[model samples]
Target: MAQTGWDDGQALIPPDMYTDWTAVALLLLTAAPLAIVVGTAGFFIWKQKRSSQR
Candidate 1:
């Protein structure tokens, strides 16, 4: 049977998972603002082209 005591070296098990919530939140926040700006600029450019074509 396997040992079941603190001195058995079980504490050496590596962590199975890790999460960086702050980095995720920062990426999401930055992407949203950049997307909004790019979308708005694209819309204006399309409108100007349509008007110029008339």
Candidate 2:
């Protein structure tokens, strides 16, 4: 962001979560486990409902 460091919030190539690879990797690594847990819970809920229906 050397190009727009002085500006407030708009940068052509800012190293934030959207465009920066390092930041994106950090975010994915942090959120992957939570995402897996959410998916597992959803699958279990679906299985439980299906079993009850049958």
Candidate 3:
């Protein structure tokens, strides 16, 4: 028999699992917008409070 070069212990992702990446990407996409909106609101509120304290 010819030598099969790959090691038996190597890890590989099968093609069917590729869709899992898309699901994760969608989750991040949803989270990013929410985070941006919350951050912006918090920054504005902080600035308003700081200016009012003078």
Backbone atom clashes (below 3 Å) for every candidate: 0, 0, 0
* lDDT (10s digit) by residue, model 1, range 1-54: 774554466766445546789999999999999999999999999999999999
Question: How big is the positional error of residue 33 in model 1, measured in Å on the Cα after superposition?
Answer: 0.3
Q: What is the lDDT of residue 31 in candidate 1?
A: 100
Better of 1 and 3 by lDDT: 1
Give the whole-model CA lDDT for all candidates, comma-separated. Answer: 0.85, 0.81, 0.81
Candidate 2 error regions (>4 Å): 1-21
In candidate 1, which residue ranges exceed 4 Å CA deviation? Answer: 1-16
The deviation in Å at residue 15 for candidate 2 is 11
Better of 1 and 2 by TM-score: 1
Question: Measured by TM-score, how close is model 3 to the native structure?
Answer: 0.62
RMSD of 2: 5.9
Instruction: Give each prediction's root-mean-square deviation over alpha carbons.
Output: 7.4, 5.9, 5.2
lDDT of 2 by residue, 6-53 (tens): 356665555552656888899999899999999999999999999999
**Which one wins on TM-score?**
1
